[model samples]
Target: MDGHRIRVGTASWTDPSLIQCKRFYPPGCTSAEGRLRYYADKFPLVEVDSSYYALPSARNAHAWVERTPDDFAFNLKAFRLFTGHQTPAKALPKDVQQALAGHFAVKKNLYYKDTPAEIRDLLWHRFENAVRPLREAGKLRALHFQFAPWVTRSARAQDHILECQRRLAGYHLAVEFRHRSWFEGDAAGDTLAFERAHDLTHVVVDEPQGFENSIPTVWAVTSPKLAILRLHGRNAATWNIGGEAASDRFNYDYSDAELGALVAPLRETASLAGETHAIFNNNYGDQGQRNAATLQALLDGA
Candidate 1:
C-alpha cells in the first residue's frame, strides 16, 4: 500500500517527558528493554536522539537489534562533535578522554576542529564500529547530521559535510542545516545540488521561522533512497529558550487541522523518494507519538 512507503514516527521513544507523562507506555513497560519492545510494536521507525549526546556503544546497538522487530528501522542522530556542536569532554569514551588529555589540556567542551587528525579518525572508527550491528541487521536507515546554527553555507562547511560522507561510505547520510544561509537566495540551489552530487538526503524540517538559524521548508528530494520530513512544531517563543529539558524548547501540540494541511505535500514527497519518513520532534510528553499516529492515519485514509 502507498501508506507503507511513508513511515511516520517520533524522534525518540524514551524522552523524559514522554515517560513522565504516563500516557503512552503501559505500567509493566518500565524496563528499557520492555519500553523499546512496546514502542516498536506501535511505530515501525524511531530516531535515536540519545546517540547525539553520547557515542552509542556496540553492546547497546546489539541489544536494540535483538529487541526490535525484523522490519523496524532506526535513524540515529550523529554525535554532537560530528555535527559541529560543542561537545563536552565527558561525553567521549574514557580512552578518548585520556587521548585528548595527552594532546592538550582537557577543556569543558571540544569541537571537531579542536581535535587532532588522529583523534578525529579514532572517533570516526569507533562510531562506525559501534553501529555495525544495526547495519548488519538491516535496521539502520540513516545517520542524521543536524549541523549547528553557526555552520553557515561556506566552502569549509561543505567540505566538512563531504568528509562525513566519505567516512561513512556505505551508510545513508541525512543532512539537516540549521542556518538559513544554506537556503538563502542562490545558495539553496547550490546546497541541493551538492547533496544530490554526494548522494546525501536533504532533511526537510518544519519549525519556527524568522530566526537566523531557522531554515525555510524545502520540499525537494535530493536522494532517491529516502526523504525525511521532521516536524519540530511552531513554538516560536521556545525556539531559542534553553530549558532544563528538550520539551521546553519543542513544546507545541500540532492540531489536526495543521496536520491535514500537510497531507498533499507529504504524499508528493513520498512519491519522489523510495520511502518518506515523517518524524515528529515535538517531544513534550506524548505529543510526538500522538501527532505521528494521527498523521499516519490521515495519510492512509487519504
Candidate 2:
C-alpha cells in the first residue's frame, strides 16, 4: 500500500436503514454501544453524521472512546446552524432553546446570522467543549464544516471561514463547499489557496453534478495534514429534492465502476497529504459499508 495513511469508512454507522440492514453488525448487536463496537472493529474511521442535526455531548464522546480501540478515529460533522444552514429550533438543547426566548417568535428554523452574538459565542464554546473528550482521547479526525448551498463564494463568505478557523484553533477542520461557485472558475484556485493558507482541509467531494448546489469533483489536497473524500453517490434526481431526509437524498448505491474511477485520484491525493480519508456518504442501507470496504481493498492494492 501507499506510505501515507489511507482510511476508508462510511459517513455514519447508525443510519436507520443501515441498522435494519442487519448484515454489517453481527447477531444481537442491537444496543447502540454494541453496534458501535462492532463497527469500530470493521472500520478504522467513521464520520459522525448525527452531529449535523443535534449538538454532540462530551458524555457520548467519552462513551465512544471507551467502546472503540485506541486507533479508531471519528470525523464529526459540525452542527447545521454553525455552518450557515437552517437549523430547527427543536434540534437545539432544551436549555439553549429557552435562552433564545427573544427570537422564539421569529421562526422555527434559524440560521447563523439570525442568532444573537452572545448565543453564537456560547454555541462555539459548547461545540468545542463537547468535542474535548474526543480530542483528548485522540479519536477526533476533524470537525467537518459542510456549509449550506446558498453559501456562495464571496468576500464575506471567505471571511466567515477565516473566522471559523480562528475560533476553532488547534482543531483539524475540513471545509466542504456545497455551492458550485466556490469551485467553478478562478474561484477554485482562490479557494484552494485560502484553505492552504489557513491550514483548513479542503473536503474533496464525489457528488451529483449539474445541480445548482453541486461542487464538481475537483480532486486536490489543500492541507498537508489530511485530505478527505466524501462519496455522495451520483443520484442527481433526489440530490436536490426538498423535504427529504439526508439518507433519502444520498440513497444511490456506488458501483464498482464509480469506486474504480476514484482510485487514481485518491492515490494521488494521498501521496500529497499525511493521511487521506475516503468516506462513503451514500448511506441508504449497507451500501456505504460495502462500498467503503471495496474502496479500501482497491487502495490496498494501489
Predicted structure 2: clash tally: 0
Tens digit per residue, CA lDDT, model 1, 113-145: 988899899999999999889999999989999
Question: Model 2 residue 291 lDDT?
Answer: 94
Question: How much lDDT does each candidate structure score?
Answer: 0.92, 0.89
List candidate 2 stretches off by more than 4 Å.
1-3
Give the C-alpha lDDT of model 1. Answer: 0.92
What are the root-mean-square deviations of the candidates from the true structure over C-alphas? 1.6, 1.5
The list of candidate 1 runs beyond 4 A from truth reads: 1-4, 102-106
